[model samples]
Target chain A: MANRVAVIGIGQTHHRSKREDVSIAGLVREAAQRALDDAGCTWADIDAVVVGKAPDMFEGIMMPEHYLAAALGAVGKPMFRVHTAGSVGGSTALVAAHLVAAGLHQRVLTVAFEKQSDSDAMWALSVPQPFSAPLLAGAGGYFAPIIRAYMRRSGAPNDVGMRVAVKDRLQALKNPYAHLHLPDISMKMVEESVLLWDPLHYLESCPSSDGAAAMVLGSEQAATVAESATGRRPAWVHGMAMRSEPTMFAGRDQVNPQAGRDCAKDVYAQAGITNPRAELDCAEVYVPFSWYEPMWLENLGFAAQGEGWKLTESGATALDGGDIPWNCSGGVLSSNPIGASGMLRFLEAALQVRGMAGEHQVEGARKALGHAYGGGAQFFAMWIVGSERPN
Target chain B: MSKIPATRQGHRPVAIVGFSQNHSVRSDSTSNEVEMLLPVIHDVFDRAGLTKDEIGFICSGSTDYLIGGPFSFVTALDAIGVWPPKSESHVEMDGAWALYEAFVRLQEGDLDTALVYGFGKSSLGDLDEIFNLQLDPYTMAPLHPDLVSLAALQARAVIDQGLGTEEDFARIAARSRRDAMNNPFAQIKRDDDVATLMSEPYLVSPLRRHCLPPISDGASAIILAAGEKAFDYAEHPAWITGIDHRIETHAFGARNLAVSTSTAKAGAIAGVGEGHVDVAELLTPFAHQELIVKAALGLADSVSINPSGGPLSANPLMSGGLNRLGEAAQAILDGRATRTVAHATGGPLLQQNLVCVLEGA
Candidate 1:
């Protein structure tokens, strides 16, 4: 039988447009050191380290993990790098969790980061390839058509996205680590922002920040010891799932990606969640654009098709009074470091389940979901965590 | 103090039941990355007597930098014809690490079978200029030191430390390429002697062109089955008795360049010393690295190393490590050896190393 696993520590660097003060290694060390401290253990306690990131082009460093091993105290230790596009951070954590769940290691450290200031992601992403039409658009250009398709299909009001942009920025006021703390954020402000992509305003898009997120995953035995040592509860992992599909094919639904749906189903089955909106007290989902909030709501089975926009417009996802609050730590919309975005969501979910999400905490949030998607909506990873161990 | 856990005992037995690879070439213009992968994917699935749906999990290894595009692995999934969506994951590292992930995933016992594949087209771009980006951005990358120059530095260290001379590198190159004559998939095959290779011009100080691997386009796939399924997939399955990987600091200047401490540690954990190795496949990008890696693994002269020519004949960047593991497993299935050790390396100067011990049942 697989061993039970728990997240004993969580740490993240303050999201910012540029981390000019630290080298890439220093940037990651900031989070890893904090994670080690929170775990009440040293690097010696970690049996392995797994690092994840988006395209190396984002930082102009191919396999930066090689240079970072020394700083992460991974020398003479097993180190693995995961890259599944934007979802890499979540997958990286899942890989680390597997080590503990398989009884192969007692404690595992996982970190994901993106140093976007090192290089221009737009140019790197626009590079022409052989035999394929060039996609000169940055990520926004590619997703704009999809957003337009969603608007046409759902008949959602244009203000729905503006509402999300305003709500998330308000949530960021409570998160000290969030990159964009717009104290004066409002729906009118979002409407006044320039349209970076069709149907998506500048305020709706995620910021390109430089940041890192780290977590210490421990086996059940190690978690018990850590809980006693730290005088805090560990977030027990209830389920983990990953799914993938071809980027382009006939009948492929990019709006409601099958991969994301299957991934959610797999994780929910493991967590024994029959109704996601009711069972999952809150969620931290990958929503780089404000419109993705409703899109993912339907894909995650939180709301029925075409009705997901109703949940967003009704103020049900707001951190202050929403029943199933989403992205209470401001989410990717407010602060995104590309590669670290997925991990930040996963970390935020763990924080909520453990009641460590201080100002952004959902009252009595006992169960939470962390979700991520990447590669043209083709790859998905998700996990469910709770305050109590699963039966 | 080395903190490697003592190799665990009495684990679920997993075996490499099927393996396939494409013909290595200087540049395969006829086939794109997906085209190169389809045949090998089908071959492995057919050899395992399974279909796409039967495989419980799939994993792949590749990097976007190789092809100068993002999400290369995303399109490659089309080769598998994923209609219902599949349980899968990917790594930025070499396919050997992909195998490692699958190995760990299979250990969870939720899945019984997995398919792993890796591919790279080194001919896509100027690798020498492209590889410079792999260095430490704040330190080494700014220097614009290409990969050959870096390997030359390691070669200089080997000679300076009296580990080996230029003649030894020539001998390794000669032996490896000559062995390639027997490998139909090898990109570079010649029976040239060490004396002939010694007369060649130096690509870098103390290293000749022959010492480096060819810029090849290739892909490899493997099918892994755990427990009783291993028996159902293959007649003589190459059971993975032990496997482990370790990495060292990237500051190559701070460490002994002539030694691979990471490989040595991984070899010990993989139990490479426990049994007699009849054959070994080492992923050595440079000819001189063969000596450094052999020493690290504690392989004896009697061991038949690189019987299939190895990376010196054809080195496909992301898939090279997994190919080494596949070649060793193939030898076991072919009745060439009862026990074999396979080693794979990544990063500069063999900074990262993985070792696996396979035994025939």
Candidate 2:
């Protein structure tokens, strides 16, 4: 096996409902270029480009990496595309890093994007099959029943969800690239927001935005080279893990998915993390809905079983002063471009460890966790990035 | 090559320990993707003398556009009974790419085995129209040119370039179809005269019906084991000595229609520079593309090509490419050849290409 790889560069675009100015190819390029620039390299400096996007229905284009390959300067190099639903972004990055960790490519460019404006996500996701439950109401609807189950089981205060929404929106104010930046976001605004999925209000749900996220992953040798070239330390990859379970299976525990827990456990073990709640400085987790923040907190072992709501109830997850400042660069709830959302969180965590998160930088952060789950929480991907090089 | 720029990490050399495929057909549309993969999945595990519980990772590739639904991969999981959960992933591309990802992931040392599968049913919609979705929507889909016409454009360009004649293209179809006679999974076969093919009417102007790959409906699965573990599974493993893939521009105008840059680059990167190849399976849905790929990969004229008749005989859209890889590996497993190369191509005008070099061990 090869030595550990590091995340040397990261960049993301301002996610919005529609980036009308740029084409889909350009949208991805924007992030890729920024990542390369941050790494102090050009397209020629990269080895391969691994990308991921949601269903082609969103863009009405098939396997778009082929067309965009030249645009990304992947003409003479290996190029790949991955799709695992919402987790695609995280999975794409993980796959790219594996190439580096496995001693394949030195400087890999992995990007994930979605131009949701080109087509309706709801329609694309709701294309009814012969005998499947119609996703007529979009992703939030399918997840709401599970959310209700968590509410009933945990008996957490209703305020927990509202608090998470307010916190993430406030965090978005600090992130210039985040969508849904409410200058004066409050709990009332969230309460007054129209209800889409019952028990999940509009403000509580994630926004469907067009955006892209990119990262340049490197092996140990490339890491040293990048550090010397950019005058910046690399965020070493400590651990990564992914898991999936079939949807609609009998006794499929959607409320507290086993795959999610198992993935976190595996990553934590690999990272030598005995106590995620205290060992890690912060995390950037996929929480499209507010309640998911605490839910995932517990799932990731950041909090004890059924007691994650307490962490949210306390001011323990905020950037001002918290044991674990989650989503300091805003998260999936604040800005989402489906395919790229997970990678954005991942890249943000790397940024924090690299001390390049600008206004949302977590002070003295050394280790951070980036997490994302998709396919009705049946798919999970997470990585640990640290300030120090990992063996 | 020590200073070779833009290279990714190397994964543990993985081997094809076991494989199972459905009887290729033309009208498997009625059977859902999950249903088609059910027996095949079990058969692959049985062939490997293992169980799903032993497989470390499960990755699949297929296009949602083929099924006209988003998250097609999610629904297809029922076939494998992924209920207890497993390390899994899916790619929107062909299963060939999925194998690449799994091959790389196997480098983690934690996973000694991986399962990769792909399936597609092209009978639900008119294949020509459905394929348009593979093109850029705003610029290409709106124009709605079918694959046959697009391929004809390439075919015409290749002919104009004086690379191959229309007769040469017909011979490829004739030869592959005739060879496909013994392939139980092939969708079409014929030993008709090359002159007869030349006399046939054009499906698209300048391209005869025989030149096109028959629309196919099928699913395929292959088992991969890494390092020493591969020996425990198969007595003679088809070891993937080298594998690489690259992409070309999507805009037909930007890419050279007569040549496949991606294939050539991937071939060189995949160590086609190494020892001689005994057999080669080229994923050329169109007849002329076989010659194009053969030239790009620099395969020796003495090498046997697509002994399973190639994609010109049966094309399953998303899964076709991986089938090519499996076909070549089967040759190695059967001791028919000591070394072979398999190539898979995707996207319009052959925008994406993957090359896998398999060696018997």
Candidate 3:
């Protein structure tokens, strides 16, 4: 049997559009140092370091982990780099956890970041290639059609997207590190925002920010020591899973991807969760676009097919008094660093289970889920964390 | 700071069951990465007598800079035809690291088989300019130092320290090309003596043209199975007895380039010296790097090195390391050797290294 693993500490940067105050190395170090401090450990305690980011073209550097090894205290240690498009942050964390779960290491430090301010992410993603039609625009342009398809198939109200935009921005007000804290956010503000892509307004899309997220994952022995030293309970990892499919295939379901469903099923099976809506106290999911909130709801089995938007319209996902809160710490819609956005969702879930989310803590949260999808919605990664260890 | 054992308690035994590779060439102008990998993937499955549905997991290693586009690996997933959606992941490192990930996943006892692949087309872009991006962006990369100059610096260190001479470099290059003549997948095959190779003009100081690896475009795939599944796939599985990788400080000034300290550490952890090694395949893009890695691994003089000619004959950037591992496992599978060692390096002047010890069961 595999060894047990837990998240003993978590940290993230104060995401912003431009962090000119520090370099890329400084941005990642900011999160890593805080995570180390929170775990009540030093550099010597970490056995290995795992780094993740988007494409190298985002920062005009190829394999930045080789350069940042010193800053991350990885000298004379095993260092790994992971890149799986936007889901990289979550996958990077899973890779680190596996190192401990496989009985290979005691404590592992994992960090993911994206300094989009250094280079044009849109340009890097939209580079035209040979023998391919120039039908591609930005990510917004590519995903807009998928959102339109979801709307037509589900027959959801147009205002549903606008409502999600306003609700997440309001939640951002409670998160000190959120990049967009729109205190005056409302339905009117979202409706008035300019439409960048068809059916996607400026406010409905995620912001391009510079930030990072880090977590300290440890084996059972290491977790026991961390709890005694810090007097803080760790978030035990109940289950984790990742799935992928081809980017483009005939008859593929883009709106409700099978990969996301399969990944969710596998993780839920490991956690022994039958009814996610009743079992999970909260969730932090990747929703770069407002419509994705409802789309992922169905894909993740939180709601039945074609009825996920009803949950949003009924205020069931609201943080204040909702039955099952989602994105309690803002989420990707509020601050997206491209790479770190996924880890933020994962970190927020862990924070809720640990009762460490200061302002946005879901009351009495016993179990929570974190989700991330990337690469034309073809890759999915999800994990369930709980307050108590698994049997 | 405790020493990590070769195989930790409760760890599962994973073995290489099948392997295949495309013919190395200066440029694969007709095919993209997906097209190049399709045949290799199929060949690996066929050799192992398995189908795509049997693969429990899939992981790939590649970089987007070669294609000058983001999410290159995303489209390359077509090679596997993952219609039903499969458990998978990707690494930005070499295929060896991808195999490492699969190995760890198997230890969970949830997955029995995994397919690992790596591909690169070094001819697509200006490799010299592209490699500069790996340096410190704030310091070294701004100077635009090409990779050859960095390797030359390491070669100079080796010579000045009396570790080797120019003639030794020539002999190593000569032997590699001579050995490549028998390998159909090799890009460069020749029969040139050390004297003839030494007469060639230097590309960089102390480094001749023959010392550099061929700029080839290639792809490779390997199948790994755990427990009983390994025996069903191969007559004699090359069980991964030990595997470990380590990275050094990025700053070239802070490192002793003449010696591969990271390699030594990983080799020691992987138990490279625990028993006799019959054959070793070392990923030495530059001829002199072979000597450095061989010494770090402490392979005996009786151990055969690069019987498949190694990277000096055909080096594809991302796949070279995986190719070393495949070649080493091939020696064990073919019954030519019962035990073997494989070494793969990354970064300028060997800033990172991985070592794997395999034994036939």
**Poorly placed runs, candidate 1 (over 4 Å):** B1-9
Per-residue lDDT of model 3, residues A146-180, tens digit only: 99999999999998888889888888899999999
Model 3 lDDT per residue over B1-361, tens place: 3111134234688889999999999999999899999999999999899999999999999988887788778988999999799999999988889999999899888789999999998889999888899999999998998888889999999999888889999999999999999999999999999999999998999899998999999999999999878888998888888888999999999988889999999999888999999989999899999889988999888888998999999998788899999999998788888889999887788899999998885
Query: Which has the higher DockQ value, candidate number 1 or candidate number 2?
Result: 1
Interface RMSD of each: 1.0, 1.5, 0.9
Model 2, which residues run further than 4 Å from truth?
Answer: B1-11
lDDT of 1 by residue, B1-361 (tens): 4111223344567889899998999999988899999999999988889888888889999988898888788888888888799889899889999999998999889999999999999998999877887777788888889888899999999999988999999988899899999999899999998889999999999889999999999999999988878878888888888899999998988889899999999999889988899999999989889989999999999999999899999998889989999999999878878889899888888999999998886
CAPRI band for model 2: medium
> Least accurate stretch of 10 residues (summed lDDT) in model 2 chain A?
A129-138
What is the C-alpha DockQ of each candidate? 0.78, 0.69, 0.82
**Which docking category, incorrect, acceptable, medium or high, applies to candidate 3?**
high
Weakest lDDT window of 10 consecutive positions for candidate 3 chain A: A129-138
Candidate 2, residues B156-205: lDDT per residue as tens digits?
Answer: 98898888998998999998999999898887877889999999988886
lDDT of 2 by residue, A178-250 (tens): 9889988899999999988878889999999999999999888888888899899889999988899887688
Q: For this target, which candidate reaches the highest DockQ against the unseen true structure?
A: 3
